[model samples]
Target chain A: MRESDKDIIRSLKIFSDVDERLFETLVTAAYAQRFPAQVDLIHEGESADFLYIVLEGCVELFASSHGRETSMAIVSPVSTFVLAATVKDAPYLMSARTVDPSKLLLIPSQNVRDVFDQDPAFARAIVTELATCYRSVVKSMKNLKLRTAIERVGNYILRLHDKSGKADIVELPFGKRNLASILGMTPENLSRAFGALQSHGILMDGARIEIIDRAALETVSKPNPLIDDFRS
Target chain B: MRESDKDIIRSLKIFSDVDERLFETLVTAAYAQRFPAQVDLIHEGESADFLYIVLEGCVELFASSHGRETSMAIVSPVSTFVLAATVKDAPYLMSARTVDPSKLLLIPSQNVRDVFDQDPAFARAIVTELATCYRSVVKSMKNLKLRTAIERVGNYILRLHDKSGKADIVELPFGKRNLASILGMTPENLSRAFGALQSHGILMDGARIEIIDRAALETVSKPNPLIDDFRS
Candidate 1:
């Protein structure tokens, strides 16, 4: 195994406590590849043949119905995608594509299942990882079903601001178009939602966002830790 | 162990392959209780102490934001809620309440974790269970984000119809108000969505629904199996 690849695998919290022997088996079966920007890594409904770990660059996980695609999540470097589908050997529910030229490690689904069965530590880690992923999606559902588009935008900015350690101005990580879909809104609606937040003390200049009146925004946004806090 | 409790535990696909001794440990720690209709079993943000398994009746799992609550899911008999939270000892993301008088088995979180660590069979079962749950929520997110409210209503009805076998007429399992919240809409909007579906050949009388024109509803719904199929 490549030293760099081994390092990446070791870095993931899921593999942190696994036996070195089992980890060696995992690393032996895994192979890394690079993809250009906007390349579809996996399509919805395709048999989940492999679990892709983003080694570098971002991947957008989205689902489409009636030709309209809504972004579900953005998997960043050093994280895995479609783990549940891969574990169960089920068809992918969401399509994944790179936002920029990316390097990813692909491990066969069968290997994942086999390793999971052989190593109790690996299995335990998978339980924790899958549980976290499940709760995260549940949080997303609550965010979608409980809040309006503008509220979503407001809380999202607040979360970013919080993550940046109280930076008054925070830059959007991805493009507005993708963020709109991630927030479950149309591009036009996203524009209008940002306009609505302006009344709540936000000033958007290109990718940079300035929270002019945090107090006022909090009144409108009502960011709850259960819904807004990602780290938990 | 009660014969009934052991029977229920054995029936769950998650526990089907586990050793009988471990199943006895689970059953010993589990205690069943009955609740009146509209009882709140667990609230969001509370530390998850126990995992609740529904033996009978239904539970509505919902989240509240800024004083407005939206139902996230309806858990029926033989299923579990807040499993991820219980497994990780994390705060519940969604509050669970009985939609009707319900019977539930409560298993201490610590016991669950202990058994999980000691029994590889149990750990594997949890892996499969958690993976199934993660995929289920992903499917829900896709339903909420990728489809409109009316389309959600349409597909939901289609799903209920599908679950009921070839029956053209189906009765809603819960009240319309709760169903409205579950579908992420105001009661009025739900009514409007139902009215909109009337044009697509759906007839609703109280809780009973008849799909007069399956093809028309399917066309309007555009129910792709990737987004709408529940059994997969």
Candidate 2:
């Protein structure tokens, strides 16, 4: 790995507190690779051989069952995916694929477990990371269970609006199909939901969504921090 | 706390490996209380003051929005809940209630955090516990997204059947109303689904169900270990 890449990995929250020598050991055992867009990186039900950290571009974590597939999460740069599976020595619950040409660091799962056992800081960090992940999924469950598709889409748009610096227009991060899967809606349902949101004062022009009236939209979305806040 | 209660708490997976002194400290700061059925234990937006371990009976983790409530998980004896919220010092993302007259041990969130920081064993256990929780939620999300309501009910029956030692008779752990919420369906829909399952070789009588033909039921459920296996 390049010194620059080691520096980037070192800055990650999960690794930042590890002992320097152990961190060095981890990075030495790790390797980075680049993959083209739409390439399947891992498949569900496979043994988790490595813990993946995306250094650049985007990766989609998804799952399939009985001839059906759904998007589970979208991982962007500087974040790790599949840590739980790695730590537990369990099979990957979801498959991962690149949405854009991406670079990722693959740390052998055995090394991660070994380091985690030896390094208290790393163990604590893993605890925090996993707890955050658990809470996020719980929130997502609430979003899925408590809200209707239109409400989910409305709240999602409000989240984007806030993330884009309260800008009047916000771009969809990925394709509508992925967004539909993320929101637990069919593509046709998503389109219809977007149409329904127009009555609440938003305009969708392909991927670029214009928030004509933020207040009107919030009245409909009623985005709650317990469900919508990612940072917490 | 009673000595017996402490023994129960000590044997819990999250606390099993902690230093004896630390375990005593945690239990010293903890207290056990009994709640009647239908009592709310914690609200969704409330700060997580304590981590709870169910000792007897059952607790239902649930969430609500737009005046609609959904059951998240049903917690039984000798397992912890809200560990993610306690570890993160975040508000509870879901409300919890006793599904039956229940007893629970409550450890102050601060003490849990302090113990977690001081005891590497405890930290490691917490990591393992949280990772398990995260994976379970991911599985649930997949179950929700990839399957229809009837399929979910069918798979749920198969799970209960296996849990009952392959007995032809299996009892629903909770009432139809709560089961419906847990399955992400209305009670009416759950009834309809159960009615539909009768044609697939199962008979439902209130909370009691008889699996007349396991093979036929499995055919409809197509119970995939990737989605149905909780032990992993």
True contacts kept of 1: 0.87
Deviating ranges (above 4 Å) for candidate 2: none
Which candidate number would show the highest TM-score if scored against the true structure? Answer: 2
Would you list the C-alpha lDDT of every candidate in the order shown?
A: 0.86, 0.90
The residue pairs that clash in candidate 1, if any, are none
Question: lDDT for model 2, on a 0 to 1 scale?
Answer: 0.90
Superposition TM-score, candidate 1 onto the true structure = 0.96
- Stretches of candidate 1 off by over 4 Å are none
| Number of the top-ranking candidate, with lDDT as the measure | 2
Task: Evaluate fnat for each of the predicted models and list the values in order.
Answer: 0.87, 0.82
A1-232 in candidate 2: lDDT tens per residue? 9998888888888899999999988999999999999999999999999999999999999999989999988899777899999989999999999998999999999999988888888887877877877887898899999898998999999999889999989999899999999999899999999999999989999999999999999899878898998788
| Top DockQ model | 2
lDDT of 2 at A167: 94
